[model samples]
Target: MINPFAPIGRGVLGVLAEIGRFTAFAARAAASCFAPPVFAGQLLRQCMAIGYYSLPVIGLTAVFIGAALALNIYVGGARFNAESFVPNIVVLGITRELGPVLAGLMLAGRVSAGIAAEIGTMRVTEQLDAMTTLSTDPFKFLIAPRVMAATITLPLLVVVADIIGVMGGYLVAVNSLDFNGATYLRNTFDFLENQDVILGLVKAAVFGFIIAAMGAYQGYNSSGGALGVGRATTNAVVGSIVLILALNYLITAFFVE
Candidate 1:
């Protein structure tokens, strides 16, 4: 009774099972996002919790990153008497790449973990089910608002991070490294194009959506108990980070021309 088709059947079933689950969840979340008794208060709270609360961490990270980037660029560009390009490169790199990527990764670690743990706990305690029994659309009331808030707020955070990061670089260039402030700002503005800034903002928006969606998806689907919740939290952070990197490349490619 050794069946050669058994392995193939099992593999096929596994793929189908995952696809079905993913599709069902996506459909439900999407439907709830639009067909909602809009939870404005919940959404605002989430925006503040996920967005405003993250500013300190993002700002600190951006400052250090910008300073280091300036130093590196200065050193590298100095090698060939290309020191004049330092401000331009630093600004472009921080605004167009580092700002969005770092902000996204930071949020992924902070916000995603919180969302996953909170939602996973609600699920484990059967609170989500209780809401369901009460004729409440759990997806609309919880997941959609959080996701929408994150998608809207994360870009604003990145924008702020970009400004702070550039200022950090400017400080290094002006005070620590002894350069003219006026000259540095002039070079930064002159070298930076509108497209560069736009590209970064676009990247930020995509990263925001990815972070929220991944967190919501993993948390909403988590099962088991404490262990499952922990796993989902871990997955949310890891998944969001990976997706941020992958999407960055794709977006870069699109704008490369």
Candidate 2:
């Protein structure tokens, strides 16, 4: 007789196994970051690719998010004659929460998927195997640099996003909301604290590690061929976004309390 609980057991076991594999992969990647024979060139390239190339989308997303956030806050505040708090709330939301979370989500879609596809293709084509035969550690040569670069660059991106996001709120507040430009700027500046910025950057760094690790892990384990690579790319993005949201809450809770 077929056991009714067998399917549930299998699903739970599969999830546990996947979690174990991912944990081990992340540990190895973390260890590889400090190992010798650093790939300076690859690291630099990845920094440029992950950081510089990511600015346009990050900027646009921040600006739009800030603008929309300002508008919503203003409308909500107007209901209770609290409209003057727009600048304060906008700045706080951008730096403390929205900026890092949005940036991480955007990067998970862009960087994680790209990494998976690039590495997955390489895997399917046996390039990783070739590197192995040539005495090159794929972890050192490929994964480590990408992982380290992502970790290093994301905080910088969050800083820029925070600035642009505040600027976005500033523009809307001045042009449409008819607030005194100087007062709006002053409110924003005064309300923003170093702690908020630091918190966001800390979140960004953790999100970065998750993004790169998920991508490389999915790509490295991918089999089959083109179809499999495509599937891995999808999984990388999905996994990164899930982890990003979950960790954001945990980090915020830890620091906020």
Candidate 3:
């Protein structure tokens, strides 16, 4: 007799096995991050690549998101004669949620895929093996630097995103919404607290770690050739986004209470 639940059980087992492997890889990567023989130059280069280079996209996205958020908040709040809450809500939304989440998602698509492709190509081409032969630990030289860079830079990016996001809301409110510039700024500042910003930055750090870790994990384990690299890249992006969203909710819940 054919069991209907067989396929479902196998799928569940497969997912659990994947989770276990990823958790093991993440542990090794975290340990390598703290181990000695730090590569300063590689770390700096990665910081530039992952953080500085990502600014334009993050800024552009944040600004537009903030503007749109303000518009929506205004429209929604107007029904309750609470349109004046737009500045407060916009600032709160940008600092506490949108800035970090949007930045993380953007980096998952951009930085995570780039890391996966680069490392996966190295893996398939035997470049990573050559490093092993040369007595240089690839984890220390490659993974650690990229991981450290992403972890350090993402919070900074979120800070910039928050600032730009607020400015975007301010511009829209003052110009299009007929709000007084001073009043909007005042409300935005008055309602926003340091704890909110801190929690968001903390989320950015975790998201950054997830982005780099997932990319490195997929690329490091990739096999075959071009097809493998392509698969790794896709997995890196998808895995990062899923982890970021899941962790975002968890972290928010932790901090909210």
TM-score on alpha carbons, each prediction: 0.90, 0.98, 0.99
Consecutive 10-residue window with the lowest summed lDDT within model 3: 24-33
Per-residue lDDT for 82-118 in model 2, tens only?
A: 9999999999999999999999999999999999999
Q: After superposition, which runs of candidate 1 have C-alpha atoms over 4 Å from their true positions?
A: 1-28
How far is 213's C-alpha from truth in model 3 (Å)? 0.3
Residue pairs with clashing backbones, model 1: none
Structural RMSD, model 3: 0.7
Could you tell me the lDDT of residue 110 within candidate 2?
94
Tens digits of per-residue lDDT, candidate 3, 1-257, equal 99999999999999999999999988888899899999999999999999999999999999999999999999999999999999999989998899999999999999999999999999999999999999999999999999899999999999999999999998899899999999999999899999999999999999999999999999999999999999999999999999999999999999999
Compose the digit string of candidate 1's lDDT tens values, residues 114-218.
888898899988999999999988888888888788778878998888889989999999987888999999998899898888898899877877777778788
Candidate ranking (TM-score, best to worst): 3, 2, 1
Instruction: Supply every candidate's count of residue pairs whose N, Cα or C atoms clash at under 3 angstroms.
Output: 0, 0, 0
- Ten-residue region with minimum lDDT total, candidate 2: 185-194
The alpha-carbon deviation from the true structure for residue 214 of candidate 1, after best TM-score superposition, in angstroms, is 1.2
lDDT of 1: 0.87
Which is the leading candidate under TM-score? 3
